[model samples]
Target chain A: MTANRPLILLTNDDGIHAEGIRYLTIAMEHVGEYWVVAPEAEQSAVGHSITLYDPIKAHEISKNGSFYGYGISGTPADSVKLAIHSLLPRVPDLVISGINNGANVGINVLYSGTVSAATEAAILGVPAMAVSLAQKKNPPFQWVVPHVERLALWLLKFGLPPGVALNVNIPAIPPEALRGYKLTRQRLAKMRESFEEREDPRGNRYYWLSGEVPIEESDDSLDATALNDGFVSITPLFYDLTAHSHLQDLATALKNLT
Target chain B: MTANRPLILLTNDDGIHAEGIRYLTIAMEHVGEYWVVAPEAEQSAVGHSITLYDPIKAHEISKNGSFYGYGISGTPADSVKLAIHSLLPRVPDLVISGINNGANVGINVLYSGTVSAATEAAILGVPAMAVSLAQKKNPPFQWVVPHVERLALWLLKFGLPPGVALNVNIPAIPPEALRGYKLTRQRLAKMRESFEEREDPRGNRYYWLSGEVPIEESDDSLDATALNDGFVSITPLFYDLTAHSHLQDLATALKNLT
Candidate 1:
């Protein structure tokens, strides 16, 4: 635990071979001593799920001609858990999940494997952040690499409070054209989703989950809006699911139940 | 859309054929019209995941020579999404997820497919509650059926606040020996986990995620403690992951990051 050279654990929901983490590892190399531990396959939308009731296999992954990190047959949460508890030589000072393939904003935060990995790290008493490039497909990871490096360095200097992790989203645009960062809240705008119905070869009716129909939003202080307007979005997130605001009212209402 | 006959959508993470869901259906039948749409395979701890890239297939399932409901090859979240958006007769009056075999308390709520299914419904503007019998194996759903019925009747009369879902955990005790229900907050106790290492037929080492070491906790109001002491724990939860308390401090700390 050298104060000068912090141990930064690197992970992603995308498979170990994904371009995002590869670029992120290259970026974090300058920030601190980076150790990579991530899923063996793409684990998008897996949330905080862990592999229980089954055996998980972790293999040492290598890139080019050298060792990369460990690739585990588990969810993003599993990767972080395994890395912190069993793999890392010592506890990491900071954990960075992603440089994800797509922006994780709005309700996506609850369903995202990228953010979940960071959440796991935070729960395990580490300063963590989940970063995402706004592009859904074929994102320019190099353009955003410096931005991630800058933010991660800042994060290493200014540690996250206990039980908190940052959900960061960068706009998918040329760095020259991009605006600066903005502190934002996760969007609560109504999103409508429908499924795509199809018949497989066996005459069975199947449905593929479709995209969200983005409802109109009048609020500009939300993460979704900030990303669309060419700003990097940083929303501090925590894992506590309790509706603290509704606690009193809920107690009063449910008192009549029994 | 009659108010008296509430249309209740039933689902679980333990798959459609799990005894928990079967008992849940029977319990809901007395409350209102019950429609069962659930995953064909066990999806415990899947969290709020929905299958996006994969095609989801659904088939009509019948129990006791009668049409039971639809079974889908999807997650608990996917089942709820498909049911509300496409499959159901109308928007369900309420969605009750579980009669799950295990408790969803503290951090488990974030990783529980049962709680996540209810959470998905709450997001889609429906009153929802996830019911878990705090028994890990062979949970007797019979004792808790009447209690669930009473709770459902109460919920029908007094609707939940918007953006809120209830995570209900009943103790795994007998009806007479059980202590009364208590409104509880999600536990924040620390848990230590270790993985068991084993070798497969091919001499490949694999690890199975093991149970948590329950650090001694003194907080009686937390869901985990309440459940342990033979009390039903109802924690109101929301999907917004923002660390509202830390937002101001975080904003001030990162102001110099740029």
Candidate 2:
């Protein structure tokens, strides 16, 4: 609600204390007055979920400077909901979610808390972006800050079209190794998620979820493909889940049921 | 993969023992040979999330008669994934998620584990449907069974287009009171979620999540609108999240950054 500068609201799937959101808050500070409201715990794969049956508590956490924020014990979407509707005094100019620990690309975005936060903001009519670094190891987020800052400035300067948000995935390499940006599509490929069944002390079996990130080579048209080749990938995502093409066929088929 | 009848795999967000899935199993049995793989506990709003960080355990739960199933300690999407990839002896011809305890309409579907389960199956190239009863109170699921059976039969016979699924919501009224069906669009309304801040016995503060569902009157083309008018609402849903219309505009806007 700052009249002096454009207000930016920040959130992440990683807990509020995670290095990702901390760095994101720093990067966004240079462009606009920002606030951080994120999950109190890691909510990595908890997609656009909200806490309907449980209590969602928010406690304000002190940051050193002008950055004010709260940590909510709920999913990433709940953090955004409480921040926008209850915590903040005024509506935000832009909502930026993450410098996520891992890349949100391809079909993985469907299950991404990082992307879901941005999508929730877009549904509420605010322009938003979800930024992630494509590294499972220690991501050089310091190197990625400049790109985030640039994108934030660009988004603020030119507001996105209605019902759209940018899903940006940066290569994990150092700044010098970056090959610039690629405006790409969210690809159809998915991670090969497999489970390992293990027996606990009681001889009962439990399954541990594990998956291999896709390493298949893809063309520049795909976000994962561009990121794999050391390019930053920005994909325009929407909240409308309708398969517009299938509408006609479905309508026709359902008519036969009558 | 049964030759005599179509094979339908059923799952729900309301856990394996919910009356919704039980009714769904009964309806599907008349149409096809079916199996249930669902969450052991209620996982409403868990979206398309998979169990990546935790160990998931599956134990067989026997329902008297041919309704044999497995209950998994995971989200609805995880149940579908485990069933299709590991548990099921053969790939099912169709996947039906829910007959959910509550309606999943408009933007709420984005946070729905019920819809997410079906979306997961569609991602893997199986025809899928998410059936929900549009009542917050005790839903008359028996009245909705014929509608479910008819739709399941139609979908199996004609087959859904690739990457598409039907999100069906039936009225809570008696079968005769039902006003027939309407193939509608996913509306653009959302639940207004609010958190009630409370203090624990130790003086620690916590917030409970609750919300007022949107009651705004929408046009007949909307799923919420149709359901409100006592009509069965069927929305064609897809897994592609791209805002295809805004791609050109966004690409042109971000071109200056390069």
Candidate 3:
């Protein structure tokens, strides 16, 4: 098992000490040598933010005098970028972000620092994957290790195509309760967002953002639908945001402006 | 002129009083009635981060005894979300973000708070646009006004397709130096990154992230190409990240695992 292990770079939106990344690193330990570079704080919905305005400090943490990980004072994407460019001894064969505490699905993926870490790696021409256990809170770590290990190994063996990254969401149920897995699309729906307004003692007003419910898409091909059906949903995502189909019509519409 | 004017919602990654957004509002004044909801401080490169852990305070500021805008103590995306959810009188007919001080092109859009604000508005089902005056430093605001006005008027007349947004980047040139506008794709290339290491007085080390020359995509239809050609680049972007063509192959690749 040690003869031909692929080098893996592991990161997460959750800080280096989160149970999710701890389990992910443990599960990955048998598969390959891993380098943990993650945020020092929870960066849940930070999206693809990078640190350009300020200096980033990477503090090396250790357990029992062995190399543990780097605690980066930045976002998830920053951790990955800093690792690949400055921290790692060499380029990793694969980059895995998460085994996140809660799921990242639907239009919510746009705000996910978990997915952004993997997406950042892919942007730098590395094979990347983002894994999340679907639940509002922490999923059972013991139940999630195998699912993460299997996919991490699979991705290493069968490399992803250029410009693509795998977004994997697993059901929170035990491994035995998992029905199967399916390749899916990002859903079209988003949070039915609302805010709670409050007045301060000084008569100033403030508000808190709240997502009461998700407006789910019913299509079976969507990640939301498959995850809801108790299946591991693997969605192949890319960074190309161009709506290719509309280019011609939009060009026609803007022709008169020139 | 105000009769039946389109109701516009204007926001920016730069604080409300940034000259870029100020010029944007001034240019947009004649076209429609607009509501400004922008970050209170520079939120450059924050991407799509939303404030979930803390309460957001929005202070309404008035100019010359009239309503100016809401100064939000959050990221660009948070301001847009808060405005739509709690501040705006009703759903805005259109949303426009930026007139950003720098170019948000190539693969760098992933880290752009300017583009994220517009993308957030589109996710909430409004027609939105993100406009940038491309430069390393502030571009001449006086020269950018007409470009902003013409496009704003054009979009108000011809609504954008659902879930789609226009990421517009104008070259840093006098209005007369402009060559025209082209519909383009986001480039595939990214920054060649490096880190500059420095030590504090206490001997603690830190690194500042820096980007060297861009690894440019040479395609003629790309945003980088258009901008380099002195043309305004209008890239039609969306949040759906699915790599549709790879879905079938990935499904086949993962068949043995289940």
Count of backbone clashes, every candidate in sequence: 0, 1, 0
TM-score of chain B only, all predictions? 0.96, 0.94, 0.95
For candidate 1, write residues A1-258 as lDDT tens digits. 365698999899988888898888888878889999999999998977988877789999878889999999999999998888888998999889997988999988888999999999999889899999988779998988898789888888778888789999999899998888888888876577788888878888988777686676757679999898999999998888888988888878877976
TM values, all candidates:
0.97, 0.94, 0.97
RMSD of each: 1.4, 2.2, 1.8
**Pairs with steric clashes in candidate 3:** none
Model 3 alpha-carbon drift over 4 Å, by segment: A1-4, B1-3
- Name model 1 segments beyond 4 Å from true: none
The sequence of per-residue lDDT tens digits that candidate 1 reaches over residues B1-258 is 365699999999999999998888778877999999999999998988988778888999998999998898989998999999989989998899998998888887888999999999999989899999988878989988987788888878888889788999998898898888888888865577877778889988788777686666769879999999999898888888988888788878878887
Instruction: Work out the iRMS of candidate 3.
Output: 1.1
**Residue pairs in steric clash, candidate 1?**
none
* Candidate of highest TM-score: 1
User: Whole-model Cα lDDT per candidate?
Assistant: 0.88, 0.86, 0.87
Task: Kindly list the per-residue Cα lDDT of model 2 for residues B56-133, writing each as its tens digit.
Answer: 888888866654799999999999888887788788999999878788998888989999999999887889999999
Q: What does the i-RMS of model 2 come to?
A: 1.6
